[model samples]
Target: MTAPRKARSALDLATVVLSLMVGALGIWTILAGPTELLPIHYNAAGQADDWGSRELLGGGLAGLALLTLLLGGGMALAAGRTDDPARRRALRYAQLVVVLSIPLISLLIASASLSGATDISGALPVALMSLVILLIGAFLGRVGPNPFVGVRTPWAYKSRLSWERSNRLAGRLFFVIGLAGLLTAPFAPQPLGLYAIVGAIVLAAVWSGVESWRVWRTDPDRQPF
Candidate 1:
């Protein structure tokens, strides 16, 4: 594990800006918008099924914005603590993902709140999730041992080689599924695309874990348990 240290970078600054944007959007929406209950929750079918006061929606967005700020700032400050260049790079990429998610999530919230219809297709959420997954997959293979990221498993943690191999496989799966999501989310039947995306993620995670365990079991230096 890498030690924690104070470090600052451009991405860290961007995170601050992104977080503020989310907060500002939420506040602005609450102050200048309809007082009717906003769509605060969506069902599996991608339809807004739950409603709440504008305060609920605004507060939730603000909370998420704060979390994003913390994660981004923390990751940036901690980036220099890791001696491994690969891990450092991976951390930065992860921060980027977190930072980017702020805008996408805010957009989803705004869309859901503003929409007058009850049955909105889940395309936007699916697309956003896919985009995030794709971005993460692009750099997942570069992530070294970190409890906070990558494919952490008993076997993966047992061996650096296993971790690398498992993450590489996971990265490919994520990229593939994300690409599939991007392609199908627009036209797929209601909820099917979401289900497919979830299924793909589960399959990838299971496969990666199994691969890690197998790799660990076959290692020449393995110790009997």
Candidate 2:
């Protein structure tokens, strides 16, 4: 595995910036945000904003703000350790996705109340943007010398071909689904849009693993560490 030395590049500074943006947006969202139509939570059952006005763990705007802080802090810290140029670049892209998400999701969720929508019409865009970010993260992890992220299937980590193939598949699936999610956002039902994003990713992950093994089996120079 390639290990990154302790150094902060100009790109690393950007990671700090990203966290700040997320943190700032989170604060703004929590302060001004009404009960969002969709909020990510721990429970699968899904609850409402019961944790008070400023509390994120309780739900609503607080939740996003808290997440922003955590994600921002995480990215900043990670940036300091990473060595690969590709991973660094990918992180930059990740910041853009995260930055775009604040207003897009906040507005979309608030719009649900105005639209009086059970699922709302804006979820497609949300899901799609998120999907793209997810993919970028995967690509960076796979290409970088990180043991913690990316595909990380036993086969993938063990073999160079597997890692490359799996990551490529992942990248393509994420890009396509993201586009599909955006285009399908208005036409498809909310549930369907969500499902499409989820399903496409799952399919890619599975196929990547299977394909990795196949490549290993066929290649004379197979290496599965």
Candidate 3:
């Protein structure tokens, strides 16, 4: 098989394997995990603030595993339907992100619950989310006009220049913010670090939307609304 075909097969296999692994873990948790209430929520100081049953935790893992499969399937379908090489690549990358994230989150939760941990550090989740943001930013600029992903504004849809420029700008902002968040997560105050990252993402999104409109207004080939 060709290199691209091999790569696609590998990704497909990985998606299936990850889904099965998470699903099996969920089943195991349900069958053998602690029967008592488990800490389901944590405060900024890593103290347990809420509790839940093993079923809730196991069900969540199962749900996430199912979501991963659904997202992977949807991305594959979208890729198959699109002829644009750039769009297909972007879809593939998005699928990869979903595959990596769902399993990672499931395992993290499972580990915490099974280990009878009362409190979980907030830094890890923040760092992981930052890493995800960085990964998405690394590819955002390459994504072609698509409804499924990447800063989809109406202006961006009407103008290719708007799409490209706005996504590139957003990409840069996300990359920088993500890097800063990742670096500071371990040192910054718990909730503050999370709040700052979320706030920055929102601001970047607003800025990118405005940029799309600004560029679309000047784009010679922009489609009329």
**lDDT (CA) per prediction:** 0.75, 0.51, 0.81
**Backbone clash pairs in model 2 (N, Cα, C under 3 Å; residues 3+ apart or in different chains), count:** 5
Number of backbone-clashing residue pairs for each candidate, in the order shown: 0, 5, 0
Off by over 4 Å in 1: 1-8, 120-125, 219-225
Ranking by lDDT: 3, 1, 2
Q: What is the TM-score of each candidate against the true structure?
A: 0.79, 0.58, 0.78
Model 3: per-residue Cα lDDT over 1-225, one tens digit each = 399778888888888889989988888778887899987766555567778888888888888888888887788778778888777887787677667667876776677767777655477767876887787677676666666567799999999899999989988998898899889988988777777887899999999999999999999999999
In candidate 1, the residue pairs with backbone N, CA or C atoms under 3 Å apart (3 or more residues apart, or in different chains) clash, namely: none
- Superposed on all Cα atoms, model 1 deviates from the true structure by an RMSD in Å of 4.5
Candidate 3 regions off by >4 Å?
41-49, 112-125, 145-147
The most accurate candidate by lDDT is 3
For residues 184-218, what per-residue lDDT tens digits would candidate 2 score against the true structure? 66667655556566667678778777876777677
Candidate 2 lDDT (Cα, whole model)?
0.51
| Model 1: lDDT of residue 143 | 64
For model 1, how does the per-residue alpha-carbon lDDT over 1-225 read when each residue is reduced to its tens digit? 333323344566678888898888778767776788777777666677888877777777788888888877777767778777776777786676666655666666677676644654567667777887787677676666666667899888887778889988988988888888888878887677787788889999999999888888888764445
| Candidate 2 segments exceeding 4 Å error | 1-10, 25-39, 42-53, 58-142, 223-225
